[model samples]
Target: MLQPVPFPIRKECPPGACICERERLLDDPQGDTRILRLTSEEEKRLVARIDSISTYADLQHIEERMREQLGIDLRISPGMHEVRTVRGFNIQIVERPGLCRKTRQSIPAAIRRCLDKNPDIAYAILNAHDLLRDD
Candidate 1:
Protein backbone atom coordinates (compact mmCIF):
# COMPACT_ATOMS: atom_id res chain seq x y z
CA MET A 1 0.00 0.00 0.00
CA LEU A 2 1.14 3.56 -0.67
CA GLN A 3 2.19 5.19 2.57
CA PRO A 4 0.71 8.56 3.57
CA VAL A 5 4.23 9.83 4.12
CA PRO A 6 6.80 9.77 1.30
CA PHE A 7 8.87 6.60 1.06
CA PRO A 8 12.71 6.15 1.09
CA ILE A 9 12.43 8.09 4.36
CA ARG A 10 14.98 10.55 5.69
CA LYS A 11 17.70 10.68 8.35
CA GLU A 12 15.78 13.28 10.36
CA CYS A 13 12.96 10.81 11.02
CA PRO A 14 13.56 7.77 13.22
CA PRO A 15 14.40 4.53 11.37
CA GLY A 16 11.60 2.11 10.36
CA ALA A 17 8.98 4.80 10.91
CA CYS A 18 7.19 7.52 8.93
CA ILE A 19 5.29 9.84 11.17
CA CYS A 20 3.02 11.89 8.95
CA GLU A 21 2.30 14.62 11.51
CA ARG A 22 2.37 14.03 15.21
CA GLU A 23 0.10 16.06 17.47
CA ARG A 24 3.26 16.94 19.37
CA LEU A 25 6.95 16.50 18.51
CA LEU A 26 8.36 14.40 21.31
CA ASP A 27 11.99 14.68 20.13
CA ASP A 28 11.86 18.40 19.43
CA PRO A 29 12.38 20.72 22.40
CA GLN A 30 9.54 22.88 21.07
CA GLY A 31 6.43 20.83 20.24
CA ASP A 32 4.51 21.72 17.12
CA THR A 33 1.51 20.43 15.15
CA ARG A 34 0.51 21.02 11.56
CA ILE A 35 -2.67 22.94 10.81
CA LEU A 36 -5.34 21.41 8.59
CA ARG A 37 -5.43 22.43 4.92
CA LEU A 38 -8.84 21.85 3.42
CA THR A 39 -9.39 21.54 -0.30
CA SER A 40 -11.56 24.09 -2.17
CA GLU A 41 -14.25 21.50 -2.84
CA GLU A 42 -14.22 20.37 0.80
CA GLU A 43 -14.59 23.95 2.00
CA LYS A 44 -17.46 24.52 -0.42
CA ARG A 45 -19.17 21.36 0.77
CA LEU A 46 -18.80 22.41 4.40
CA VAL A 47 -20.26 25.85 3.75
CA ALA A 48 -23.14 24.37 1.81
CA ARG A 49 -23.94 21.99 4.63
CA ILE A 50 -23.67 24.63 7.31
CA ASP A 51 -26.02 26.94 5.40
CA SER A 52 -28.85 24.46 5.74
CA ILE A 53 -28.97 24.14 9.51
CA SER A 54 -31.27 26.01 11.94
CA THR A 55 -31.86 26.15 15.70
CA TYR A 56 -34.60 23.52 16.17
CA ALA A 57 -34.35 21.64 12.88
CA ASP A 58 -31.55 19.57 14.33
CA LEU A 59 -27.98 19.70 13.00
CA GLN A 60 -29.32 18.96 9.55
CA HIS A 61 -31.06 22.30 9.68
CA ILE A 62 -27.71 24.07 9.46
CA GLU A 63 -26.84 22.32 6.21
CA GLU A 64 -30.24 22.90 4.68
CA ARG A 65 -30.28 26.55 5.67
CA MET A 66 -26.85 27.04 4.17
CA ARG A 67 -27.99 25.65 0.84
CA GLU A 68 -31.05 27.87 0.87
CA GLN A 69 -29.19 31.02 1.86
CA LEU A 70 -26.24 30.46 -0.47
CA GLY A 71 -25.58 29.00 -3.91
CA ILE A 72 -23.08 26.43 -2.51
CA ASP A 73 -24.05 22.77 -2.47
CA LEU A 74 -23.00 19.66 -0.50
CA ARG A 75 -23.41 15.94 -1.01
CA ILE A 76 -22.60 14.80 2.52
CA SER A 77 -24.47 15.58 5.74
CA PRO A 78 -22.37 15.81 8.88
CA GLY A 79 -23.44 14.48 12.29
CA MET A 80 -24.10 15.76 15.83
CA HIS A 81 -23.86 14.59 19.45
CA GLU A 82 -24.81 15.31 23.06
CA VAL A 83 -22.34 15.18 25.94
CA ARG A 84 -22.43 15.27 29.74
CA THR A 85 -20.12 17.50 31.75
CA VAL A 86 -17.52 16.24 34.26
CA ARG A 87 -20.12 16.66 36.97
CA GLY A 88 -22.25 14.22 34.93
CA PHE A 89 -25.21 16.56 35.19
CA ASN A 90 -25.33 19.47 32.73
CA ILE A 91 -25.93 18.79 29.03
CA GLN A 92 -24.47 20.48 25.96
CA ILE A 93 -25.24 19.42 22.40
CA VAL A 94 -22.64 19.61 19.65
CA GLU A 95 -22.08 18.34 16.13
CA ARG A 96 -20.06 15.16 15.46
CA PRO A 97 -19.82 12.50 12.76
CA GLY A 98 -19.76 9.50 15.14
CA LEU A 99 -22.91 10.95 16.70
CA CYS A 100 -25.24 11.49 13.71
CA ARG A 101 -25.93 10.85 10.01
CA LYS A 102 -28.66 11.04 7.36
CA THR A 103 -30.24 7.74 8.35
CA ARG A 104 -29.56 8.16 12.09
CA GLN A 105 -32.13 10.69 13.31
CA SER A 106 -32.59 9.58 16.92
CA ILE A 107 -29.18 10.44 18.40
CA PRO A 108 -30.08 13.88 19.75
CA ALA A 109 -33.49 12.79 20.89
CA ALA A 110 -32.05 9.74 22.54
CA ILE A 111 -29.48 11.82 24.32
CA ARG A 112 -32.03 14.38 25.44
CA ARG A 113 -34.39 11.64 26.60
CA CYS A 114 -31.60 9.89 28.43
CA LEU A 115 -30.64 13.14 30.15
CA ASP A 116 -34.22 14.09 30.99
CA LYS A 117 -35.04 10.68 32.32
CA ASN A 118 -31.84 10.11 34.22
CA PRO A 119 -31.93 11.83 37.59
CA ASP A 120 -28.20 11.37 37.99
CA ILE A 121 -27.49 13.43 34.87
CA ALA A 122 -27.75 17.15 35.59
CA TYR A 123 -27.11 18.10 31.95
CA ALA A 124 -25.44 17.01 28.73
CA ILE A 125 -23.49 18.42 25.81
CA LEU A 126 -22.83 17.40 22.20
CA ASN A 127 -19.52 16.50 20.66
CA ALA A 128 -18.83 19.13 17.99
CA HIS A 129 -16.94 16.86 15.59
CA ASP A 130 -14.63 13.92 15.11
CA LEU A 131 -12.08 16.07 13.24
CA LEU A 132 -9.26 14.93 15.51
CA ARG A 133 -10.00 11.28 14.70
CA ASP A 134 -10.61 11.87 10.97
CA ASP A 135 -7.75 11.50 8.55
Candidate 2:
Protein backbone atom coordinates (compact mmCIF):
# COMPACT_ATOMS: atom_id res chain seq x y z
CA MET A 1 0.00 0.00 0.00
CA LEU A 2 1.22 3.50 -0.83
CA GLN A 3 1.35 6.07 1.91
CA PRO A 4 -0.49 9.36 1.40
CA VAL A 5 1.58 12.53 1.28
CA PRO A 6 0.72 15.17 3.83
CA PHE A 7 -0.02 18.72 2.73
CA PRO A 8 0.32 21.88 4.70
CA ILE A 9 -2.90 23.25 6.16
CA ARG A 10 -4.01 26.34 4.25
CA LYS A 11 -4.25 29.33 6.51
CA GLU A 12 -7.77 30.62 7.02
CA CYS A 13 -8.64 34.30 6.72
CA PRO A 14 -11.77 36.19 7.79
CA PRO A 15 -14.27 37.50 5.33
CA GLY A 16 -13.36 40.62 3.30
CA ALA A 17 -10.10 41.55 1.63
CA CYS A 18 -7.17 40.32 3.63
CA ILE A 19 -3.49 40.42 2.77
CA CYS A 20 -2.68 37.75 5.30
CA GLU A 21 -3.05 34.93 2.82
CA ARG A 22 -3.58 36.36 -0.62
CA GLU A 23 -3.93 33.88 -3.45
CA ARG A 24 -2.09 34.36 -6.72
CA LEU A 25 -3.97 33.81 -9.95
CA LEU A 26 -1.82 32.22 -12.61
CA ASP A 27 -1.08 28.98 -14.41
CA ASP A 28 0.34 26.82 -11.65
CA PRO A 29 0.47 23.16 -12.45
CA GLN A 30 1.56 22.60 -8.89
CA GLY A 31 -1.40 24.29 -7.12
CA ASP A 32 -2.47 27.57 -5.47
CA THR A 33 0.21 30.18 -4.93
CA ARG A 34 0.91 31.74 -1.53
CA ILE A 35 2.00 35.35 -1.08
CA LEU A 36 4.52 36.49 1.53
CA ARG A 37 2.98 39.27 3.57
CA LEU A 38 5.24 41.91 5.09
CA THR A 39 5.36 42.85 8.73
CA SER A 40 4.36 46.31 10.00
CA GLU A 41 7.96 47.46 10.32
CA GLU A 42 8.79 46.05 6.91
CA GLU A 43 5.76 47.79 5.42
CA LYS A 44 6.85 51.10 6.91
CA ARG A 45 10.36 50.69 5.55
CA LEU A 46 9.00 49.79 2.14
CA VAL A 47 6.73 52.83 2.09
CA ALA A 48 9.67 55.04 2.99
CA ARG A 49 11.77 53.58 0.21
CA ILE A 50 8.95 54.06 -2.25
CA ASP A 51 8.74 57.68 -1.24
CA SER A 52 12.47 58.16 -1.82
CA ILE A 53 12.45 57.24 -5.48
CA SER A 54 13.21 60.46 -7.39
CA THR A 55 14.46 59.14 -10.70
CA TYR A 56 13.95 56.33 -13.19
CA ALA A 57 17.51 55.19 -12.59
CA ASP A 58 16.78 54.59 -8.93
CA LEU A 59 13.79 52.40 -9.79
CA GLN A 60 15.80 50.49 -12.37
CA HIS A 61 18.56 49.82 -9.86
CA ILE A 62 16.06 48.38 -7.37
CA GLU A 63 14.50 46.16 -10.00
CA GLU A 64 17.88 44.81 -11.06
CA ARG A 65 18.94 44.05 -7.51
CA MET A 66 15.66 42.27 -6.72
CA ARG A 67 15.86 40.05 -9.79
CA GLU A 68 19.48 39.19 -9.12
CA GLN A 69 19.03 38.46 -5.44
CA LEU A 70 15.47 37.21 -4.92
CA GLY A 71 14.79 35.48 -8.22
CA ILE A 72 11.24 36.89 -8.20
CA ASP A 73 9.49 38.73 -10.98
CA LEU A 74 8.20 42.29 -10.51
CA ARG A 75 5.09 43.50 -12.29
CA ILE A 76 3.43 46.93 -12.32
CA SER A 77 0.36 48.07 -14.19
CA PRO A 78 -2.58 50.46 -14.00
CA GLY A 79 -5.36 49.14 -11.76
CA MET A 80 -8.50 50.42 -10.10
CA HIS A 81 -8.69 50.81 -6.35
CA GLU A 82 -10.83 52.58 -3.71
CA VAL A 83 -9.46 55.89 -4.95
CA ARG A 84 -10.15 56.51 -8.60
CA THR A 85 -6.65 57.78 -9.30
CA VAL A 86 -4.81 55.13 -7.31
CA ARG A 87 -3.29 52.08 -8.97
CA GLY A 88 -3.08 48.51 -7.72
CA PHE A 89 0.04 46.35 -7.99
CA ASN A 90 1.47 43.09 -6.81
CA ILE A 91 4.97 41.80 -6.02
CA GLN A 92 4.56 38.10 -5.52
CA ILE A 93 6.76 35.40 -4.00
CA VAL A 94 4.95 32.30 -5.14
CA GLU A 95 5.12 28.93 -3.38
CA ARG A 96 3.19 26.11 -4.98
CA PRO A 97 1.53 23.23 -3.12
CA GLY A 98 3.74 20.75 -4.95
CA LEU A 99 6.69 21.92 -2.89
CA CYS A 100 7.43 20.28 0.43
CA ARG A 101 5.46 21.86 3.31
CA LYS A 102 8.70 22.69 5.06
CA THR A 103 10.10 24.46 1.99
CA ARG A 104 6.86 26.36 1.51
CA GLN A 105 6.75 27.50 5.12
CA SER A 106 10.38 28.63 5.02
CA ILE A 107 9.72 31.06 2.16
CA PRO A 108 8.94 34.00 4.44
CA ALA A 109 12.00 33.44 6.62
CA ALA A 110 14.14 33.00 3.53
CA ILE A 111 12.85 36.27 2.15
CA ARG A 112 13.52 37.99 5.45
CA ARG A 113 17.07 36.68 5.43
CA CYS A 114 17.57 37.98 1.90
CA LEU A 115 16.07 41.33 2.87
CA ASP A 116 18.34 41.59 5.91
CA LYS A 117 21.36 40.73 3.77
CA ASN A 118 20.35 43.13 0.96
CA PRO A 119 17.38 45.42 1.56
CA ASP A 120 17.20 46.84 -1.94
CA ILE A 121 14.95 43.95 -2.99
CA ALA A 122 12.27 45.10 -0.59
CA TYR A 123 12.55 48.58 -2.04
CA ALA A 124 11.99 47.18 -5.49
CA ILE A 125 8.74 45.56 -4.42
CA LEU A 126 7.54 48.71 -2.75
CA ASN A 127 8.45 50.94 -5.67
CA ALA A 128 6.75 48.66 -8.19
CA HIS A 129 3.33 50.20 -7.51
CA ASP A 130 4.74 53.68 -7.96
CA LEU A 131 5.84 52.91 -11.49
CA LEU A 132 2.38 53.24 -13.00
CA ARG A 133 1.38 56.00 -10.60
CA ASP A 134 4.25 58.23 -11.64
CA ASP A 135 3.52 57.86 -15.29
The top-ranked prediction according to TM-score is 2
What tens-digit string does per-residue lDDT give for candidate 1 at 73-92?
32321333333333332223
How does each model score on lDDT? 0.31, 0.40
Write the residue-wise lDDT of candidate 2 on 1-135 in tens digits. 222224333343454534432333223434333222233344345445645555446655655654453333444333344322222322234443222333333333344444444445444544565633334
Best by lDDT: 2
- Model 1 segments more than 4 A misplaced: 1-37, 60-135
Give the range where candidate 1 is weakest over 10 consecutive residues by summed lDDT.
96-105
lDDT over C-alpha atoms for residue 20 of model 2? 35
